[model samples]
Target: MSAAADPAAATGPRALAHPGREEIRIEDVLHALADPVRLRIVRRLSGAGEGQACSRFDLPVSKSTSTHHFRVLRESGVIHQIYRGTAKVSCLRQEDLDALFPGLLDSVLRAADHQARRLGEDGHVQRTDG
Candidate 1:
């Protein structure tokens, strides 16, 4: 049978390039998250329990710009992407990130939340009290 017809060749999604966990760098990760758009993407992915399809985000930019943001995130190892059928699903590399930079992700998210609340952008301030 041809490769296309082979059962083994029919994996869930075609492989996409990503930096290995050990290959991730702090500077790259920070840079990737520096952009407002990318930061928003990361924030949304953090709350997405089962990850999210690329199309789900309603970014203000054009499609090409959106693609660029995702690419930066993927390359910097801030997020992981996999092809699910024709769509690319993305999720934060929380485990890897926490391992590499303890408390970093949480701190960033908390700061973002604080700023969001302070600016009244989302009008939702996460409570820190136990």
Candidate 2:
């Protein structure tokens, strides 16, 4: 294993790649958001006003699987990830998404919340009244 072959040796531990706002496609965003794991990641990021580190998520999937999900989100332009110190932090590309597709992000998030409550997923308490 040569140092040149190692990306960390060249750049950093992890070289995060994210799609530019202009490159973001609705199809790509929808495709990335369709997955349960990815949706959970987005939902959490939405609630978090500030960026969250990759280590903060206690997902049911394995570490590698979690990494894959994050990659999908970043590549689709649904999220922007950066290396903050040694930790890679992520946050939703809400402003960019909104600018490109008006109300799309909020609608998807609302729909996700409604579905979660409806199906009692993710500890979302289903209401019986009203």
Candidate 3:
């Protein structure tokens, strides 16, 4: 059926495309998490219990650049995004990821935390609780 003709699609905000869990490849996920900006986004989302609005992040990059990062994360199956009213909300696909590649997310998050402390960036330590 046409998306417009579907009841859920008619009432809900426009849907964003995401790879099915089975289609999520490890290479794409690793590549997406490789970028510092994208890794930061993932780390932030991991700590947030609920989906966070895109604007809630205070990334040190141009708005367009931030948008590109989010798009990469979404396309890589690292996170899921949905439009809510005028805002877009994002959250990690933790369960799917954990099931697909056990301990992968946790390992990456730990590494990020280590690097953050090692670099002494702001001297502020953040927890990677997911």
Candidate 4:
């Protein structure tokens, strides 16, 4: 059988979500992180405790892109998604991260930001105090 069709292959690194995790939308996570804008949003979100709203992030991308990024993040397990009226609130899955592997998300985001800044990318600021 093709690896995709094999249960054993399905249990590889890509299958390593939390024990009870419903399949985390891989496309969502990849699409979300694919954009420079969305990656910055995630970097900022990681510095916060939980639940940052849509308006709080200052993305240079257009509103449409912003919405798309949020949608991707929601579909991904990286962030918890919620709609509060017209505003969509997103928060890092802290408990989920701790359960899955400690410090992975924060370290990744921080390292990404640091690398981006070192390379002179403009969006790589320390997350602003909200």
Candidate 5:
């Protein structure tokens, strides 16, 4: 075999990667949720118990941008992606997240909702719970 024909050289050794039980670090998850678009995506996702299709979610962004956001979510382990026919379905990694950080996702989503309400009210809301 010619030196240039070596498959190993074409594709280096496969780096160690998690199969299905991949653990997403807290920092990565937080970073993923930090973006407004991604946060909104997550909020809509967590609101529904069932997996949502890529096109079903109403995002105020272009299709390419939406696809990029979804990719980040999936890479950060905040969401799971599975091919459903020709469409891609995404759902929150609930069990994995719960096992890693209890109540983290819930609190973040609640905080986001609270913030949105505050913004909607022109930064005025009766301070009830912190």
Candidate 6:
């Protein structure tokens, strides 16, 4: 089987590249999270609190586009990706980020959640915040 087809082979250290905690830069993280799709991914990962397979997300974008978003997040150190039985699973780098930025991730997620609640998923105003 191809490497991608064999999770065992793909689980090696070189399977994916992620910046170290010290290497993660605030600007890169912010840029990665700036995209709506990537931010949505992060929000879901935050809520899951566990590794989520890439295919599990119901992203509106095409598969290639979603992959690109994931790459951006991973490269920027906002998330970590690993292969699990022929599936790429992703989890937020919450601990690393918290240690490095001290509440930066939580703040962004909270603000995003509040905005989503206020605007609804369609981006149209649903209700005004009291």
TM-score of 1: 0.83
Estimate the TM-score of every prediction: 0.83, 0.82, 0.83, 0.64, 0.75, 0.87
- Higher lDDT: candidate 1 or 4? 1
**Model 1: per-residue Cα lDDT over 66-106, one tens digit each:** 99999999889998887777888888888889888999989
Better of 2 and 3 by TM-score: 3
The runs of at least 3 residues in candidate 3 whose Cα sits more than 4 Å from the true structure, single-residue gaps closed, are: 1-13, 122-130
Q: Which candidate is the best by lDDT?
A: 6
Among all windows of 10 consecutive residues in model 2, the one with the lowest summed lDDT is 1-10
lDDT of each: 0.83, 0.83, 0.85, 0.63, 0.75, 0.86
Candidate 6 residue runs with Cα over 4 Å from true position? 1-14, 127-130
- Cα error of candidate 1 at position 118, Å: 0.7
Put down candidate 4 lDDT per residue, 43-116, tens digits, no spaces: 88877766788898888888898887776665566666555556666776656645555666667677786778
CA RMSD, predictions in order:
7.1, 7.1, 6.5, 10.9, 10.0, 5.6
Model 5 lDDT per residue over 1-130, tens place: 3212224423434311221334578888999899988998899888888789989988889999999899888778788766656777777777777767899998999999989987673546656586
Candidate achieving higher lDDT, 4 or 6? 6
- Weakest lDDT window of 10 consecutive positions for candidate 6: 1-10
Put the candidates in TM-score order, highest first: 6, 3, 1, 2, 5, 4
State model 3's lDDT.
0.85
Estimate the overall C-alpha local distance difference test score of candidate 2: 0.83
| lDDT value, residue 11 of candidate 1 | 51
lDDT of 6 at 64: 98
Candidate 3, poorest ten consecutive residues by summed lDDT: 1-10
